[model samples]
Target chain A: MSRLDDALREALRREEPPEGFAGRVMARIEARKERAGAWDGLMAAWRGPRLRWAGALAGAVLLIGTAAYQETQRAEGEQAKRQVMLALRITGAKLDLARARIQRVGYGLGDR
Target chain B: MRIAIVVLAATLGTAWAQDIKMPPAFDKLAAKAEESVDVTLDSGMLQLGGKFLSDKDADEAKAKKLIGGLKGIYVRSFEFAKEGEYSAADVDALRSQLQPPVWSRVVGVTSKKGGEITEVYFKTSNGAQIGGLVVIDAEPKELTVVSISGAISPEDLADLGGQFGIPKVELPKSKGKEAK
Candidate 1:
């Protein structure tokens, strides 16, 4: 029992720490604080209004680009439709003129 | 060498199938014309234009239906300030391409008083169905050549003429009537 008590006393004795031990512990705590601060800063930036504004701006740009593309396509389609109508008009007029002339010439069926 | 020749022959044979090879003189005429219109719509453009056409509108709906089966529509028209901006040789060059066995002259009319000549040709496939149509209208002051390729029937032609304020001509339904 005495031997166990001596061992316990030696193990639990309050002795002065080694040189710079407190300084090293304090330095390690400061480093941990700095790491936490950097992570918080990054999170704060993500949660800030600047990021929201940037996202909104990107969305607006995408929407405007899509609208502009559709408008250009519509304009091209309108032009193509007009040209098609004109071509068909000219073709029909020519055919009609030829038919009239053929009827006048007494070539009834226009087989030639 | 044999494969190369076969490939080239196949390419040329496909080109000569239905489409008309416009003469180079058309470019010269276009440059000299007071007003010119050149519309070249391949199948892609036609399909795109057809998409934009409104089905509710009668004219657009009719046009959409007409262009549905068409592969291409090429029209070149020029109006000159003077009467002799183009020569007969230019017209003849285009006419020479419309040879027989594939193309047949269906209608030809010459008006001396009006100084106009109009010829219509049909491209027949499999000796039965009309695969294409070409119309050449040459006037004293204007010239227009229209070539439409792909499947088109005589009824479709009549419908096209009937629409767009053009008077409709009665075409005989029977192939026997068209036999020359």
Candidate 2:
């Protein structure tokens, strides 16, 4: 009976905590709550439409920039095509001159 | 059906234009040239340019037809401030790129009076279709190279003559059979 009582007392006795253990625990709890609050705030801000709107604006700007670049490239290509036609015309005229001259002399130009 | 045909033709045209190889050295001469013109048009640009051609003008209509199957047109012309700015070696370098079986020199016209030399070449494939054309004209102070890729006929080109500053090329009359 005494042994059972002793065991009960031992089990029920309050033990002394290590020094500053409660301070560490309290600090940890406070720090965790602060971190959680900050995270919560960030999540709320992200969930708002401002970030999404910003994202959409950025995408639109990028698309406009790409379209502008393509337009410039196409313009340059068109200019190049015109220049090509002109050059070919000049080339054809020159070849015609040579051929006409050769024909007038009756010395036929060589063929393939 | 017509749309499909046009799409197919455009696809084939683009495919044909990719075979040309130009010497990198030509850029150096272009810089030194007093007057220079450089043009490179791929299939896409050709089709786009075709839209602007006048339907009423016979010359434009003929050019549109001539360029129907053409994949690409590349031309480079350089007029120098003085003679001898270009070298024979540069010309030789360009000439070496053209070889037999795939390419054949069709015509050589030399005029001593103006100190001009012109050589025309046709690209042959399968003995049925001419795939490309080249013209190299060298003068005392000017040099020009024209390369057209894809299936273009001599007559189609001749159709574009007498207009657009293309002095009408009187092709030698066909006798017996045909020269081309």
Candidate 3:
């Protein structure tokens, strides 16, 4: 669309890497692989029994914490159940009293 | 003196015993409830709804038996990270369900504070009471719907609070456990 754009496009043309680029890339990749392998071997050797024991201890603590949480939930549920039963019992008793009062009133009216 | 105290406690405990024996099935149903809702079906009319919290340890057979006694159970819940996620269209959809031959809308109350609309409906069959429905629109907080069926006294409905476990009345204390 413009002469400036055409000149810029001509100035910048696509080109391949140098002839030894492929070989240089392969050499770098091999070096990285060797370094990674050695690092992994070193890490495995450094991981002693103490580290394993620490991991296991942490896991056990987590398990115990989970169990305690579950027990607390269970206890709360039981307490709620007890409260509900008590309330229901009270309501039933009140209804009974109301019924009795009504019956007494009816009997008194009959006597009159 | 201890014997007298024990006798008095026994007497009080016997008097405090519940008269109405709610069916065992109802007990199981109450146990399953997680959250209980209370709303006035109409201005001065009351209704209650309970949401049961499902549990893996729950007895399936017993829960089923308890649910079977219930005439109607309806639930409508919305989850939003922020407020104002719902529109009037959502409420209208629910209102439409309460329309027609089944229910007659009695009153509609709207609140300016929360933009909440409470619509009450009464259901009848041959001019006799059957059921009632209540739709509440509360924004930025919560929304609730309560559907009540069977012959529930209006007075009893008004007494219901958030606690769904059971009703409490003054009762005599028990003494037999103390002796043991």
TM-score of each: 0.77, 0.62, 0.32
Give the clashing pairs for model 1: none
* Best-to-worst TM-score order: 1, 2, 3
Number of the top-ranking candidate, with TM-score as the measure:
1
Q: How well is candidate 3 docked (DockQ)?
A: 0.01
Among residues 3 or more apart in sequence or in different chains, the pairs in candidate 3 whose N, CA or C atoms overlap within 3 Å are none
Q: What proportion of the real contacts between chains A and B does each prediction keep?
A: 0.42, 0.27, 0.01
Candidate 2 stretches greater than 4 Å from native: A1-81, A108-112, B1-18, B112-114, B169-180
Candidate closer to the true structure by TM-score (higher is better), 2 or 3: 2
Clashing pairs in 2: none
**Between 2 and 3, whose lDDT is larger?**
2
lDDT tens readout by residue for model 2, B1-180: 999999978765654444656677789999999999787878887887776666787766767777788888888889999998888788887787676656788777777898788887778765455788888889999998888888877666555445575557555663222222
Better of 1 and 2 by lDDT: 1
lDDT of 3: 0.43
Q: Tell me the tens digit of each residue's lDDT in model 1 across B71-148.
A: 999999999999989999999999988877568898888888988998999887764547898999999999999999
Candidate 2 TM-score to native: 0.62
* Better candidate by DockQ, 1 or 3: 1
lDDT of 3 by residue, B1-180 (tens): 999989977764543331111123322323333433321121111111111223343332222222322344333334445555555655665565564455566535455675655454555445333344343434454444444443333334233321233333222233211110
State each candidate's chain A TM-score.
0.59, 0.52, 0.50
Q: What is the per-residue lDDT of model 3 for residues A1-112, given as tens digits with 9 covering 90 to 100? A: 7999999898888778989999999999999999999998887766776679889989999999999987776665444333332332333333333222323323211121
